[model samples]
Target: MPHRKLQPGRLVLASHNAGKLREVAALVAPHGMQVVSAGELGLPEPAETENSFLGNAGIKALAAARAAGLPALADDSGFSVAALGGDPGVRTADWAELPGGGRDYTMAMAKVAALAEPHANRRAWFTCALVLAWPDGHTEGFEGKVHGTWVHPPRGERGFGYDPMFVPEGHSQTFGEMDPAEKHRISHRARAFALLAAACLPGAG
Candidate 1:
């Protein structure tokens, strides 16, 4: 099926995460789209019951699209350690959930570090799934990944989640240390957005 083209207009970002909202808003800015986050609109977050990145992204996007009656873009991304057998792939954010209803990424990062300490292989990767959904339930999805080594003690204070620990291949600086523009150039999310842009966004060809 031919992909539907999204015209420049108001688009909803189906996520409550500040970091994701910032990054995604930046990605869509050049395309002449006005971005509004689900949080800003007071849309409730949907449960991510899916087992894969794309699946979860679809859930979020569709929910927001239906609720807001507009096109919605959602991202589901995670950090996976090879030695851990991809233990926290889809449940990446869940790993940071606090008992009192909030997330603490510091604890989450510590858990990842401790679990992988016993293994010599520090190989890791970040995976991102991007989904665009229309109010009528139509959807498109894309996935991307970047592989690198997971470092200890974390690094820069710039990025959120596991960025401080992940060093993309061929680069010495962790995602947390690199400038936002640099990270956006080669990130897993950027790669996925490239695919979506080619397929749907105007002037992206």
Candidate 2:
């Protein structure tokens, strides 16, 4: 399919996560696109019934685009561990959902550590699936992954989610420790965003 040129307009970011919104907003900043969060618009978070990242991302993007009557961008991201057979993959976000309420990454990291304790292969990766959808139902998708290992006692406090426990293949610091600018440059989201820019904004990256 030919690349879809995204015209300048208000694009809804189909997410309530502050960190994701910030990173994605920066990635698309050069394209002159105005990014707004679903939360800002008071749009409801759609049920992510899909099993795959791309499918879930499309669900959110489509829901937001239709509700806001504007083009929308959404992403589904998670961590996969080789030892755990990529566990906490699609379940990454809810892995630490408290029994009563709330999500906790600290517990999530602890679970990962416990599961990976006996395994010699600590190889893992972060996966992100990006989707863009228009009000009319047109959509585009991109995927990106970054391989690395899991660390114990979770390090740093800069990034969110599994960042503190993930050490990218070539980096000394976990994603949680690295500067946001540096993380964005080599992040799974950044890789997907590059593809999105090439498709929708031509030469914008």
Candidate 3:
């Protein structure tokens, strides 16, 4: 099926995460699209019950599109350590869940570091799935990934999530250590957005 082209207008970012909202908004800005987040629109976050990044992204995008009556873009991304047998692939957020509710990524990072301490292989990767959905339920999906080594004693305080521990291949600085603009240029989410832009955004092809 042919991908639907997005007009220069309001686009709903179907995510409640502040970090993700910032990154995605920046990516969409150059395309002349006004970005509004689901949280800003008072839309409740839907449970991500899917087992894969694309599935979860589609769920969020579809729900937001139908509710807001506008095209919605959703991203589901995760950090996976190879030594852990990809244990936290889809449940990356779950790993950060606090007992009393909400999430604490610091604790989550510690858990990951502790678990992988004994293993010599520090290989890990970040995966992102992006989905654009229309009110009528039509959607287009894309995925991107960046492989790197996972470091202990997380460094930097820039990018959110587990970025401080992930040093992308061919780079010494973790995503958290790099300037936001630089990280935006090489991140998994950025890569996925590149595909989406070429396919849907006007003047991008």
TM agreement with the true structure for every prediction: 0.98, 0.97, 0.98
- Which regions of candidate 1 are displaced past 4 Å? none
Reference-based lDDT, residue 156, model 1:
97
Among residues 3 or more apart in sequence or in different chains, the pairs in candidate 1 whose N, CA or C atoms overlap within 3 Å are none
Put down candidate 3 lDDT per residue, 44-146, tens digits, no spaces.
9999999999999999999999999999999999999999998589999999999999999889999999999899999999999999999999999999999
lDDT of 1: 0.94
lDDT pick, better of 1 and 2? 1
Global lDDT of each candidate: 0.94, 0.92, 0.95
Tens-digit lDDT track of model 2 for 1-205: 7868888867899999998998988877677788899999999998899989999999999999999999999999999999999999999999989999889999999999998889999899999999999999999999999999999999999999999999999899999999999999999999988888888863464
Runs off by more than 4 Å, candidate 2: 202-205
Alpha-carbon shift of residue 105 in model 3 (angstroms)? 0.8
Clashing residue pair totals per candidate (backbone < 3 A): 0, 0, 0
Q: After superposition, how far is residue 72 of candidate 2 from its true place, in Å?
A: 0.2
TM-score of candidate 2 against the unseen true structure? 0.97
Question: Model 1, residue 43: displacement in angstroms?
Answer: 0.6
